[model samples]
Target chain A: MSLDAVPVAETRRKGDVEPLVRLAGPDMAAVDALIVERMQSQVPVIPMLADHLVAAGGKRLRPLLTIAAARAAGASGPIEAPVRLAAAVEFIHTATLLHDDVVDSSDLRRGKVAAHLIWGAPSSVLVGDYLFARAFELMVETGRMRALGILATASSVISEGEVLQLTRAHDLNLDQATYLRIISAKTAELFAAAAEAGAVGVDADDATVAALRAYGLNLGLAFQLADDALDYGGQSEVLGKNAGDDFREGKVTLPLLLAAARTRGREDAFWDRTINKGERTEDDFRRARELIVGSGSVAATLDLAWDYADLARDALSALPASDWRAALERLADFAVSRVA
Target chain B: MSLDAVPVAETRRKGDVEPLVRLAGPDMAAVDALIVERMQSQVPVIPMLADHLVAAGGKRLRPLLTIAAARAAGASGPIEAPVRLAAAVEFIHTATLLHDDVVDSSDLRRGKVAAHLIWGAPSSVLVGDYLFARAFELMVETGRMRALGILATASSVISEGEVLQLTRAHDLNLDQATYLRIISAKTAELFAAAAEAGAVGVDADDATVAALRAYGLNLGLAFQLADDALDYGGQSEVLGKNAGDDFREGKVTLPLLLAAARTRGREDAFWDRTINKGERTEDDFRRARELIVGSGSVAATLDLAWDYADLARDALSALPASDWRAALERLADFAVSRVA
Candidate 1:
């Protein structure tokens, strides 16, 4: 499922076309350009700050979903709506990362000093607020009620998730249900919103809208699960962050949750030492990773992720076959594959 | 104006009579109840923490404006729209105050412990996020695009104004224009939004919207200016906090802006003693107050406040002459007279 194996299918094949790639190309371009233009307006400070983060570069997967969903729904001509919505999504994501660094009190982001460490906490907080404001303003300009509703709901959900995450942090007894809810609200909501916005823009039928939403939500959940797994086992160079960053921060990711469950009675001491203990060193993190891996939690979690990715692809089965739809399927494969 | 003089206003005035007061009674009741209801849902830790600060109530003036404006337009089927909007405004205000206390590193709010001081910094930050989320959810229930637009824009403006205010802090060179823009965006934008939401809900005409916007904007400006004057001159009992909190925080309020202009030769010494010098005591604040008063800056600022109040009343004059409109007129008078 990971991108390590999927050949970059060229020019859309007979049956297996890259629908998301085809549909999202212009949309991503629009979003990319808009992000640069809007972010550039913050003269002397905002632009530079924004650029430093943008240059660190995420996968741009969320914008891809937005554009692909729009195109899949028969949207054409200008399509400024999806682009703007995509940019707003990215802004919200970036703002949260900025504040998250402060909340986590981390020093590094994408192999560089986090904004808080570089510019200070006050600057980070204000800059995050600025980005949030900028995003809302962009959303308002779209003048779409459905779009506004989706984005606003996503935003509130994101905040709720963050608070939930914070509340559950360092509490090893936190259940899987709570963790899943956190990820759904914190992460999947945006992906779902991004995809749904496209259909909303073109005034797509309810079924199509629902289908795209399902695709995005499943894809997002799978994507986050893969991310959680990779943070435990993947390389820092590929991921743009240190391995076990979550473990170091005491976050209860999927692997840790599974590992905790596995260690319930047999390895209770190990759970207390690695999971409950806050004073984690390089060796402690390493051993914890080994414990999680040995418990088969990582592989089991990957299976769950693969299932979700499959479901994501299946959600698009009802749509008419198109080059853009093919790319969405590929993107789902890539979401899981990339993490694997 | 001080609520001490007007007391209860005897009996409730009918349609358009005593717009602010009539609006105040019901809106306050509704807002207070909603705030309490929302505050109750903060869960394990944040609820009591938020309540501690929420109970130290300031006048629910922003919510009053929202409900009053809607009622003044004669839409009384259900005050739900304005009530929700009012709650949204209050939530935003509370979130900003929480962040502001942290930013200022202050220990007091309305003669009680600040949220950060009482609940710790992390709790304050997370709780602020909680309130922000709650506000958005409330907006979603209202289902008005204009309301969404106004609330989102106002919240952004507040943040921008906060950033601007931060940069201008301790810098005596801040001009009247920047001062007005900061306070207007920070304070007036929400008030304007609250009023605008009222018109938006009832689908009032553009002229009515414009008039209400103008009234809100002018009133907000006058209120802030008078607030600044009170920080330097009003007694603690009436103001609800110690005088010169602004001075202690090294904020360049309107009175300070005026006083700085009048200082001429003593400018450097004055700023140096008051702003550049950190960790001010009561004696330092007292001397700064004396300097500001001796310069006639407070009086000039008060005159400016009256000017804005007059403009507010002028805007209200365009509305139909109802009792609510009359109450709005008194609210204009109240804006300036509250601190005097």
Candidate 2:
């Protein structure tokens, strides 16, 4: 667990996202411009609240996937359509984050104070609605109904996932399959749709589009699993949120579920009180993390994440070997490598 | 102000929406069917929470406007596109209601306990989002991008208006123009878009489409103005919500604005205490209502509504003579007449 115990070569083997970021820089800049231009409104609170989150900026990974998919799928001419679709995808993601913060009552997002906390929940909710509508407006401007449908369905599926999670997230008995389904719906679906819409926007062939969508889906699963693992094994400065947020909120993510199942009757009272009864303290979180880490649950989660990352990289075999494809392969490696 | 002072003929002259309801019945039935079918999801909570609102069923006036506009614009053939758009419009409206109740923390909607109360605020917010995504999915099915654009823009405008109202709702100094802007964005934009999308769906001529949009805008303005008046003047049973909700929330609608201006110095202290200070009692609401009514503010609000209604009726002159057109004119009249 100490830095001295870790092998230097293994840390060096952990891949980076720098290649994808460097390659997609120009396209992403255009997407960012579109995002900034569209989030503005005559109402001051809207732009102010929206910019609080949008300006702070995350990895911008979803839209980058969108643009990468378009180019990787052999988009040759002007990439304006894919660029706009990429912006729309970001808008949709931002909107969901706004609503999610309000729904979860989380205190931080993208390493900044949550928009809902600063502007109040009502403004956050309304501005979320505004961004969502603007996303569709951007899609409509592309005159691509198929891409619109993809994002629309993804949006619906995401909410359904959110509702399912809200209803079942506190259950101590939740199985891993249901947890995966929830993450697939809430997190992975948008990734898949973002890639699929980008391909569709570029008039990519059906096979190419399907392959990119598969890549996105698996990459999303890997990324989310790694994220879940990171919550327990990583630092707050790195995660942009406090460790044990899931534990404190009684949210039964994969790490907790795995640790619960592995510890079975041994930690019954501990798990029951913290998760089911929703009673916890600083010491309990420390103890819970100890158990989760001591059981090798985080390692098991990262291993599964690596499997998905491999599958994501394998999906790129369908495409012609190019810098975009190679970068995407590295990106998938980075998905799980970040947890290393 | 008593019943004895009201003219019998004027009571009879106040029009009703029955004609439009009856005429749009079959198309609305299809729209209703679509709404029920689309709101269903594997996530049981989604349908249950959505049904809690959708099943209570408001007047369906917005969707009816969509159908009526299509038919009145001389769509002689099958009106499938408009029917779908009508359902989409209702979904948007229902989604907003879900978010609005959560934002306002209201107790009732459509004579039922608010969805957020029955489920939870988190569930309500997510369900609203699900319905919104489903709305765009429905619009995508129609394959009319322009229609989609109209609804998308309206959705954005509605959210802007909502945020505006949320920030300014407690301001006693809110001007008439700003108040009108808020209502137009929050309440009337959907109405205008519903009718406009309907006409566009039916491939109506540019003039007819413009006229229907105008009709919808005016009707929505009139309907919102009347509803604001009804908060002070009408019964809770008839209004499907507590009559004084706006007053209790300190939402400075047109009726309150007019009353504040009329009372000026006399009720400045009362307005300051109730709205600005956010302190209220039963006696304060009663006294405020008396002041609003005694100053003829409700009547003035209704008078403005009547003007909009007349403008709505005038918009119908662009269409040919038909029962649909006549019913629409009556519907406009009913918007204000309900306050009588």
Candidate 3:
């Protein structure tokens, strides 16, 4: 069931997020309602713009993971703690998206116009700040100081990762280690914290807490690796998934790093022209996609993704036998099987 | 005497910040060192970019106010609480500056090239985030949960105000009440929080906390109003302060709002062309300045600023007459006299 060799399919597995959603189903609605309530303000634009993005569909994967982790650790406490932390995680995630779209000049997110596009960049940045501040306020409501510290540290690490990525833009020398480092901070930090915060909410033991953090961290790495591969053209024979047009944007993800590593710099300047200099044309995107697939970098990326997914599975070995734990195990499978 | 009719003077009064600094002098160094220490990280850019802006100094007025207020309220704690909160306040201010430059597309800040100009918009945005996150970390170190809540709420309100201003940009119909609302949230929230947090650090009584909050809020309003007037034409033959440029940048502050209110619809379209459309030239800035002065909005802005200064003075009437309280009272006078 290895997906490394898959040619062109890269859509999210339909039920990958569902198992966790169902496991955490009880608190999902409450988290969603709380998000809407906390984001409210007298400033009409605050709610209008926030709702526009918040309501737009995305798998509520992060919060679901938080709730599941909390439950899997045998926390029977009122469920309020996990619910609040889940909402806070969603706020942080949404806030980052708003800022990211502005930074990337993204025209669309989740199939709608980006918030920046609709509200303008200034509003997007400012509103992102609003959401960020709101996220902390929600964190404070949990009254768990340790959980607050985890989320706050994650926020800082994520910012540092973003800065690193920004500095490395168009940098042809980006290696696997550096790419992993960046992704770990930008993407994995929140995932790890989201799960850890839940465990903290329930007063999970240190061993269980560490296990949950590891689970989240490795799963995040796997998730990002799969995403990078999908962008380069991960498709199944039955599905011909759209190769995400990331190379054209000069994004230096894992596949691009592998592709560059394999090349001998013969086309370094040409790669530089499109990927580094941002002199992109439609023709360049097609050719870049061809290079990525032809070089077997797609397979390499997925193989690496599988390795992380395995680590994620291994992290759960110490957890107690429970339906929620089993669901988390299945979620790991979905993380790697996206391309299969 | 009010400085309304003065033209071209716009520097903060020389001793306004000094008294507070001297009063809080003991903790100032530790706060400075802590900021440099906490901002350090594995990511070189975090420190490099943070230092670039942090070192290119402003008055350091906010932190001084925090420390002074803590001391004024008889804070006998380790002084660590106020020091940490002071650093956090400064970080928040710095982070906002980084983001504000990107939103405003300004090339210069503190007479130095903005970090965005040196690095880029993405770095500016992300590093601002790093500082904001670091701010919370420092806030947590105080272990004064109530103080943390105050700072967190201020951060949210500040962002809401910024978003409100962004949404209201180029809006010619912005009224006095709305304009005040925007500045109060954008600028005054932090000032009020800084003083309130300092008092909270000392476990000050509810009455003392109220007094400090009121003092900071009115001082903030007076400071911002003077700043607004200073940008238009607040100067004297002796002071020769540089008229801070706001009109050319399309900011719709109190002076411009008043000026627009005074003008009839005939010139309204002309104002729209320059302010609303952001179509400014050297000649336009000059003309805008002339229009602002000719409308007598400058004097009116200062008159309103004096009202806030008086309120700030009245807020301290309840405090025990300490040297620190007198310094704060003098600070209000200096806020109004900056342009005189």
Candidate 4:
């Protein structure tokens, strides 16, 4: 279905994460405490630099997924294991963000100056490593080998995805399938692993674990797609990052690729000059955004994100009905509702 | 004892690694194969960048220590676990080297062009991450949680050490204790983990594992001390990197710290101009090297290395008499012999 088929007011009504946030609050508090405790090191700069990013907290959505998955999987006794795993999931996400800032030379993250700008690229790189290693240490303490393997493989896949993106950065001709593959690897794999690890940590049955993983994968895709759409249509103040960052960096996202395809022959020179040759100006980004919105690419991207969100909600059918399950379903809607 | 107390020829005779290399050749071949196989990825650049560093092979000393420690601890049946752990050790080391080159902005590594130069710094950072994740993947395959813990902790310590070094880069006031702490974390901790993980993987006793770890720790210190000395005294061709690289970068290594202290009043302006101010020139480097050597700082550094070498040999006394033990004893001496 296209975005035109749905009412804007109806879509906006579906976008709320309050249910999941309230349900996961106590567990997330534990996870947050663990994150703070583990990130501490005798090397003064490590915690200082790490705290700069961790403190300027984003949604903490990945770890929230871990905690929710564990609760949904019927974990009853002490959830110390899931709590630790959730902290680890956040550490891995933060670590990747730190490295990505350095790799992309980003100027802002979570509405604050990027860590690399304040601490220098060298410190950012090393501190990212420190957090990555700490993530594994936390997993080891959990004594869950399968969960460790899931995150380890996910980490490798994420890096592979990142390198793929780096190599294909400014290519205007990047196909839809390749773009999907890049995002699936770089973003969804971690989501899948985070949920799968939590289920496995609690010794959930195979069917339950697989279902949670599927849910996380689809949810992650929806979130990323919505994020890409927001970059074109949403306000920078609300988004916590500049709106034209993707266009400015010549990053090839689904919206840009779709817009470029829609405007093919007419805007070929414009696309080549701004994206391929990398000679962009303020006027160029403004015009590019107008072209993208006018071409209906943002609506198309949101439509695709809605499809993934529906799939994510469907994947929760394996679990018995509970408040946690309903909360997760709403969270999926929230992933796409950001642009509303 | 001072360098004058020991005859030069006697110390030279103690510095060969041939025995260890010859004995570990077969196992190292297996590790080399695993390294080559695991580094390959569908993303062409991952393997290409990884191969650039892996192919321009260093001594592979860390993994060899892993193999020898397992063998010395009497791992008899199939030795597959040790072999995999050895490969994991190598991957971890190579990953660190890739990041370290980017961090230091070095032009040469393992006697060849640094990987970051061929690819960009972004690629180098991500590829290093890929190898690191792959290292954990390898360890996960062996089902050795304790070994994973050891390597995981080592990885954390190494980054902390690197951050410490980066923050203190050009400080002429760096003391010997902090210098040792930096090298211990960045260099020696991996050596200790490599050996300790091997022993632990083979189900060796606590005493035996501790001994091997001690041996690795001392050998690592000796090797780093000798490397710091070589930056001032050794030939560039033999060293596989430019001599005076530490001086050029204003790195506060042990030899520089020693020399700076020895000529404190006499060469205050020279040290201040070159190191603290970072206004180094070719002539400045030459003069600094001359002062370091003429002041007998290199000899004093080598003397400390020899002391660590002796401690490393002494730690091996816990293991039974075996070819592996003898080879490891010689490897400690080889750590110091690089500058010979």
Model 3 lDDT tens row, B1-340:
1344455335434326567767766788888999899889887888998998887657677888888788888765478889999999999999998899899887677767778888888878988999999999888877787888888899999999988887785587788788999999989888999999999988889999999999899989988887887776644332222354567678889888887878877578778898878788878766767777788887788778878888888998878888888898889888877666
* TM-score for chain B considered on its own, for each of the candidates: 0.90, 0.97, 0.91, 0.96
C-alpha root-mean-square deviation, candidate 3: 3.9
**TM per model?**
0.88, 0.98, 0.92, 0.97
By TM-score, the better pick of 2 and 3 is 2
lDDT of 2 at B147: 100
lDDT of 2 by residue, B201-282 (tens): 9999999999999999999999999899888877777888998999988899887888889999898999999999989998
Residue-wise lDDT of candidate 2 within A1-340, one digit each (tens)?
A: 4112222235434667999999999899899999999999989999898888888888999999999999999887679988989999999999999999999999988888888888999998999999999999999999999999999999999999999999998998888889999999999999999999989999999999999999999999999998888888677777887777888789999989999999998999999999999999999988988888788788788788888988988899999999999999999989887767
Name the better of 2 and 3 by DockQ. Answer: 2
Model 4 DockQ class: high
Q: List runs of model 1 lying over 4 Å from the truth.
A: A1-23, A39-44, A264-270, A273-277, B1-19, B27-57, B76-80, B140-143, B234-242, B277-282
Task: Using DockQ, give the best candidate's number.
Answer: 2
List the DockQ of the predictions in order: 0.37, 0.93, 0.74, 0.90
Q: Which stretches of candidate 4 lie over 4 Å from their true place?
A: A1-13, B1-13
Question: Among all windows of ten consecutive residues in candidate 4 chain B, which has the lowest summed lDDT?
Answer: B1-10
What residue pairs clash in candidate 2, if any at all? none
Model 1 chain B: ten consecutive residues of lowest lDDT: B1-10
Question: Cα lDDT of model 3 overall?
Answer: 0.81
Q: Write the per-residue lDDT of candidate 4 for residues B61-97, one digit (tens) a residue.
A: 9999999999999987568888999999999999899
lDDT of 1 by residue, B87-115 (tens): 88888788778877777777777777777
lDDT of 4: 0.90
